[model samples]
Target: MHYEKEDWNFELVVAGAGVGGISAALAAARLFRRVLLIEAGPEVGGTGVFSSVSLICNFRDSRGRPITSGIHRELFPAAYTHYNEQRVPTYDELALKSTYQQLLEAEPTLTVWTGCTVESADVENGRIQRLHLQGQQAGTVAAEVFLDATADGNLSAMAGMQYEIGREGDGKLQSATATFRVSGFDLLKLENPDIQTWPAIHSLRLELLPYYQALKDEGKTANPRQSITCFPYPDGKALLFNSTSVLGVDPTRPDSVSRGMEEGTRQANELFGAICGHPAFRQARLDYIAPRLGVREGRRITGEYILTAEDCLNTRHFGDMIAACAYSLDIHSPDGGATRLESIPGDGYYHIPYRSLIPVGCSNLLLASRCISGTHEAHSSYRIMASVSAIGEAAGVAASLAVIQRKKDVREVRPAHIRYVLQLRGQFTEGEVERIPLPASPQQEPPVSVEPNFKSNHD
Candidate 1:
């Protein structure tokens, strides 16, 4: 019923190694919290690395002022300076992974355990006491506070937390995509050598659609979505194709994901063959398919606040604001039709309340990813990487502050105090705060040795 090393303990434990989990660990460790970061895969980056999601969605207001700052800026430094509102936002996964490794290795208070997952959780009186980890290694870890950064709400669900999945009524989620990469395209074949620009990208897409359509007419492919949507690699040598959709794939169901992967790979290869006829792709070659499926929707953990589509459309501001999102409501069609896009009103952004990250029935647990409480429509907007990073940063700050303040219930920690720390770290915030006496800088925790298998070269 229970399994773990007895002496393992930390001030905070973060699950999953996506951008959200990494941000949470980075934020807390910098504040001198003894933190343990557990990831399921061998690699640190989640979908961003494994799925090769090439684009960086909008994180700035209409005039191009960043609404999601803090760790997000650290990951995508290009967004911090020389941000152009009209340029197509994108990044290379290889570069992002390198940045994550360097930044995480520098945090002395953070301990990373890759190839491990949160197999089970001990929840007592609405608070998490210990988490049982298994996969590459098995052990139990105890913590004063826990943050669930699993994009699928896996940790919360394991803790018996209530959650909603997919659309409100039919339970259909946005289709999953298996992205792929291609390189060695002859750039001289195109009007613009720099296809990374929005205009050049559109032009290239228009040039390749006819060939792809011909393959569809010939029944050579099963991809439902129209047109080829891809972005340039950072080096401008390769293209990351965010195409090949598979409908009704759910991450919580392993069988569904497996079948979806099979179908998605079929689509990826078919589309690749179809596009090879294009002038620009005549010399191109398929690199590889993503290791994991790119799931667009997952379990929305029930929190104190359930953000609504109306809130995003109205661009609502919260008195307990912890993070902000400026990405449009870009919902890919569940049926593989057209994508729906709705821009935020006025200031082109909306605030994410601290209450949304505080899941109900959990005293010392916080959500740090896209799984945070929100309607399917509302979740579609802030589920982008930039906002998720911001959410993780805020959740980390709240968890560490709850520890530092000696609070029995996480809700007892004042949002104003959390905002104070966030503001000091250069995160965007608008909530007014009462000046509370803060503790002196914390000394870094002594490094703890983990199982031999969990150690990385950086560790």
Candidate 2:
């Protein structure tokens, strides 16, 4: 048996280099904890860079308010070289990589490991005693606190942590799209005066109609080209398109995910080629494809407190609010169907409790990203980059506190302390926003409900 033994100790080991993992590393480093950021991919910026998402999702609250704060709020505008009318800024993938590198380089206590995959872990009692990692010819290394920042919650599953992979009732999740960039676009000539104008969009759509008709004639595709979603790239001369939707991609299954990525890429090129022949895009050229597949849904580990759809509509505020989210439910179907709830009403603000970040029955483990506690409906809103970044901040801070206090259970740490640190670091809070004045309540009796439909899938 060729077994190599090595021991590496760090205050925190953050698995995955996505927004959540990166934020965790940044936050933990600020708290003076030694953090090892491990990523399965060869490069950083998990989906942000690899998937080439042009802009950050709704950074503001329901009332068109900007809720992100702390390192995330600062990192937002910095990630973009320019912000157009789309509300989200256009991000250069290369620039984003450099930004993450620069930000991490500024942290003395931060160590980054690209192409590193965590195979398994050893958990004693509630705390994770050691985590085994392998990558780029490097053997295994251990750590004190292990964060399951992987978008798929890979680490949590390996540690025997309970989680759900898809929607409970329907056994489905929002569709996944493969994104690609097109070059040779003329920002100066394009009629899109603003990001929303998309005047050239209709032109591009018309150009793709003939191609779609041909495909349908040949029995290649059932969907038309008008169903595509295009966003302006940072350079303004380029357009990033997300038209292909891969359904039934179980994130936990590597084979399924790999297949989804391959199909998505193929679909991207097919769309790109169709657009290239158009009058508006006749001069266009294919820019680049994503290095990582864009995954819209995955295993969402059930936590101690799961935020629900009702909570979102109510704009409920928890006593231990660690962060806030305002984005509405955006569920895209694999059948090329897209659904979006533009607003959630009620001031467009909702609180993310500290309890949601900490997993139930597990110690020394924190979930960031889409895996954080919430119903499928709630996950749609919370899965956005800004909200995930906030969740990462909360988890990172909580981990730092756990290490400093030598606490075993993550729940042992006080929520107030986490809130205090987040506030000090400039994280937004409901307290900061003054509640709108409401009319006085009348002294009237209310009737009680005789029937209750409390059996919910979230339970």
Candidate 3:
């Protein structure tokens, strides 16, 4: 919907229309609450779309059961329906973006404002009273509960909430990347005829490595990555290169991000040119580079409970668990070193406690993105799209319950209540469930169906 310049009021206001923000808005709107989702970008879809990261990160546990469901499944139904470890699961960015638009538009009570940003927040005591917005809709928006899904904790920072950035030591964050798509490659020229499988894709990368290495040895590029890393599209015709590594790019700093984009794009082109020397890519075209650089780490908002690396390694369960993450702690080095990956033990997943979503000392604000409280090591695991979607869904439910129960503080809404709602919505949940009377909303719309096809020529 087109946003007009005017002051607005909502039961819930979500900042950032990325995956997390969209999930939060949809969850709340499905519950019959008035929701406003604000995005600074021209369209929905954050890193997963604009950055064009093709691979769908792990959301299933070791036993192959999905730990992250709910809105995530709705967005990427192919991932859930076509579960195959042999084939590398992926989605086209444009297809996912279309799904986001469909689900969002189906929610009658949900209003999405693209090209809008939450500039500031009005805090009274510990609660946020109003949000001053800029961009397409430049005015104040008051809400009973506010969710910070800006990925960089922009809204939480504006609300005077505490946050941590980067790793503990020198505060160096994960290296950023400028991803790009490439098509028109001859599959018959490749040793692996089936590039859709993990083994085949790995083989393809190895096959194209000599060219990339030659470029590096000749000092034709500034990228620090030693090897080529690319994922095949679901159709197996195209590939999304997530190989370039740009160091010292901080999301909170605009100047640093701008410089990073320039360097990363340069690296992307050099890499693309090098790969063209391969027999399979001789006729391949250099598809458009991702508009947004893929930033792995950002502001880790201080919450009621700070999740730690030990908690994840131990696979600890929380009584107030709201979500789960199955992805490994994959950290792209800040200094452009080798990537570090450590998988979760036992069930291959860990719980994301509800306390981690509630910003410290804030009564009505919730962290609904990767900005949620966690150590640097822990953040690397839950920062993936699937986990972030679950976090956003849980936060939305918690926020709505706070308004519905008429609780003065968000803390008053019990985790059991949130879990109950989540389980009813077909999301995976554990622990005790509190059966409570939920008020029916007349504004609630029926579920919207999404296309099963995952291919897109969106570029």
Identify the leading candidate in terms of lDDT: 3
What tens digits encode model 2's per-residue C-alpha lDDT throughout 125-153? 87677777777636665666778899878
CA lDDT of every candidate: 0.87, 0.73, 0.90
lDDT of 1: 0.87
Tell me the spans in candidate 2 whose CA falls farther than 4 Å from its real position: 1-5, 78-88, 137-140, 187-218, 222-226, 334-336, 431-459
Clashing pairs in 2: 61-65, 62-348
lDDT-wise, the better of 1 and 3 is 3
Residue-level lDDT tens digits of model 3 in 1-459: 454656688999999988899999999988899899999999999888999999889999999999989999999888999999898999999999999999999999899989988889999899899999889789999999999999999999998889899999889999999999999999999998799999999999999999999999999998998889999988888899999999999999999999999999999999999999988789999878999999988999999999998999999999999999998999998887899999998999999999999999889999999999999999999999999999999999999888877777888888887988898898988787776666576544333321222222121
TM-score of each: 0.94, 0.86, 0.95
Q: Compose the digit string of candidate 1's lDDT tens values, residues 1-459.
A: 222545478899999989999999999987788899999999799988898998988888988788988999899988678666556677888899999999999987788988998899999988898999887657788899999999999999999999999998998999899999999999889877678788888888888889889988998888888878989886778889897889999999999999999999999999898889988788899999998889889999999999999999899999888999998998888888988899997999999999999888989999999999999999999999999999999999889878876777878777777777787888888767544444445653323321122222122
Ranking by TM-score: 3, 1, 2
Q: What is the lDDT of residue 410 in candidate 1?
A: 78
Instruction: Give the best candidate by TM-score.
Output: 3
RMSD to the true structure for each prediction, in A, is 6.9, 10.4, 6.9
